[model samples]
Target: MAQTAGVKPMAIAGRVASERERCIGMTDAERAWRKQWLKDQVLASNEPVHVEEYWRERTNPIRRIYRKPLDVLFTTLAPVLGQQRAADYRYITGKLGLIAVGVLAVHYYFKYQGNDWTKKGGWRMTRTKPMVLPGQPGFPYKSERCKDSDYADRGFSKSVFGSK
Candidate 1:
């Protein structure tokens, strides 16, 4: 008859209203106990809920590092270099060829040449003098320096050169 706060009256037909009235005759405590018992029965079931397991599995952080296209190409090709047999070598070589062609296609699409600049019109290029530091000497023109600079040390140099 009277609406309670935050509660709306159900728009039930005559037969449904009679059925609901019969149902509502049960005590509040009885209804509450039955509701809690149903909830307990649901939780006590033996079957594992895969939905919970799926969410729990997803909570783990993924550790793999993301690689760029060039990084992936090099990484794949590096292992193939160690292949010894002719068939394996040929297979790897073909894969490498495909990767190279893909790289070249990307290079052409991006219009990136060996040097950065692309000359437009009939522009002439000018050569610039190399900038040298005040104290540091310019690059050695034609001298043959030892490949290993560790041998440049006095004690090691004599032993390495067999002049000690």
Candidate 2:
């Protein structure tokens, strides 16, 4: 609430306040290029700079990398799909891609690094300890007894469920 005299809150908050402030350390060519970029990309597109900046920060690098290609696709298909439909397709595809990536990441983690038992060279489906129960054959010590399958092979079927 307490703002400095003759200075906006943005300047006080370490943001370059205006074109002049942004140009302070830049060479003439750099300044001209920057001004042209702002004019063509920001102003011509009718998108607010702050809103664009917010989305840039919020989205991950993967999405940013895919954005241009997707934009070109939608733009090219715009005549057939219409503007609204093209936008919807773009949005849906982006979200679905994100979801697919997330699902694959989780699948990879669970497949390899998700469980402590796996890390310790134990059964993938169960923990390190054997799943032997009272009144069962190999009641306490034999790990092979706890597994649902009685296969003697050294794979998924041989291991039993356990916490430890």
Candidate 3:
């Protein structure tokens, strides 16, 4: 391949190394066969063929990403925890763990974080006692019903507390 005018040598070498790494596991014969197959596919197709699309079409996308991590987890735990226990742990953590974490996060947010406004200056409970209306049994000592004199003077009248 012809080198571009200002590109560094290391950058070119890194690109070639990355391309080879994509085919790392194949034997030389298998690599050659795949190369020939890809070339034939490109030649045969009327539309442009993408390498990523070719791989994704043949493999299960979910299995491809999940298989490696789950295998490592199970293998590491199997010897120490026993096979059945390890399998159960994997099932709980893989499926239920995420759901539990999400629920706890939502609960915490609503109970604490979501009430930030109440902490700043919003409505709040007070230590002061509730007001008692005039002429009620506790009016003289406990009532803070009004600051006006007419309400205080009218206290204990026959009209308020029905005649005995």
Candidate 4:
């Protein structure tokens, strides 16, 4: 190839030569860490077409937020469960864990959907749009806004307005 300084990256052909040499020089721990890190990055960067990406996208924010926790749980439990001998945790927590999450997500969706009396302006869940009026649902302020937009009145769009 066109390798220079014996270290500079070249096209696929020349780069592989240098990389193989470098890889052979690493310690066992370094090689293992590099390998595991690459796998983690791949899982984290699940492409749009991957099944994992499909569920993650369709799931709501509440369920989606638990991916890491489930990952940790499955990873930690896999070894204890005797299904996986490796420390990577993919054995017990990868697809099966995601499937469990999917089940929980569906359960949550229906559970709340059925009991959504609060959708009628009970607490934080409101189906109807907020009205834009004083002391209304979505009004900015109960009082008045400052003229300067720097002081503090009630609500003048921004708190920058000065209040009398």
Candidate 5:
């Protein structure tokens, strides 16, 4: 590799180091082999390949990026908690746990005796009815239902309801 005429030695070395880091210590031969193998695999693959495939068109990147943080967290906690238990702990204490707490809160909110401003004084019961929203069309809340909704809306609703 010929260095530029005016480039400093340190700068050249840094550039070489950066390039080396890109290949993770693999030699020129090894990098060429890997590239050739990838080309062969792509050519041999039955399915057509898209060069500009998106995050939607490819899932591996999405999966890896999303799980990286959780993986680090679980590994960090695994020694103290045990691997299986660490994973379980993350599952139980993460979003799922928040969901459990939310459900419990809703349940207690509705079912608890004299909660929700009915018992403003906090310990005593009152027969106050649940407040109604302005848009509610009365007891059954007669509202227009959609026969067909947009795909994007459906996806948004799905994620909101906790499906991956």
Candidate 6:
């Protein structure tokens, strides 16, 4: 090859060394065969081939098969807790176990005692009686019945024993 103007000697020597190394491992006949094969490959193909097409032609069909559901689940759960970079599985499992134990403890406590001990003093239970509102057109304060009653005083008499 003719030397170009202003070309560095180190660059030219590196290129020559790389070329020599490439051919050095091959036998004379094997080198010739490789050269001819490469020439044929370059000259035979004029059509544009996509990257996907090239891989599909070269790769095994079974190897290309994908577990989509597993991949999606792994991707989703990886951030939460798994073999992912952020958190170790052992630590996460321990924390989850503690939480489970706490939940169970609370559940059993409530089941046995029927109330929470933590908030025992915070809350109180009280009974309330229903009030009778005045001027509702049902009964008078001191009278037996209202003026519209069909059976006078019988319906209002039941209120004394808290029957109605």
Angstrom error at residue 129, model 5: 9.1
Please give each candidate's TM-score. 0.18, 0.38, 0.27, 0.22, 0.24, 0.20
TM-score of 1: 0.18
15 Cα displacement, candidate 4 (Å): 12
Give me the candidate number with maximum TM-score: 2
Q: What local lDDT does model 2 show for residue 128?
A: 75
The whole-model lDDT of each prediction reads 0.51, 0.67, 0.61, 0.55, 0.60, 0.53
Candidate 3: where is the Cα deviation over 4 Å?
1-60, 63-70, 108-164
Candidate that scores best on lDDT: 2
Q: What is candidate 1's CA lDDT for residue 79?
A: 70
Candidate 1 regions with alpha-carbon error over 4 angstroms: 1-84, 112-164
Q: Predict model 3's lDDT versus the native.
A: 0.61
Q: Sort by lDDT, best first.
A: 2, 3, 5, 4, 6, 1
How do the residues 34-140 of candidate 1 rate in per-residue lDDT, one tens digit apiece? 56755665664656555856765655433123223443555576576652453465556667978999998877754543322232433233445566656767643
Number of clashing pairs per prediction, in order: 0, 1, 0, 9, 0, 0
- RMSD to native, candidate 6: 24.9
Ten contiguous residues minimizing lDDT sum, candidate 4: 117-126
Superior candidate under TM-score, 1 versus 2: 2
The candidate with the higher lDDT, 2 or 5, is 2
Residue pairs in candidate 2 whose N, alpha carbon or C atoms collide under 3 angstroms:
129-164
lDDT of 2: 0.67
Name the regions of candidate 4 deviating beyond 4 angstroms.
Answer: 1-9, 12-89, 114-164
Residue-level lDDT of model 3, residues 35-99, one tens digit each, is 67556655544455558777778788787687668768887989999978998888877777679
lDDT of 2 by residue, 53-121 (tens): 788898898977869888889989999999889999999998899999999988887776654523555
Worst 10 residues of 1 by lDDT: 114-123
Off by over 4 Å in 6: 1-87, 115-164
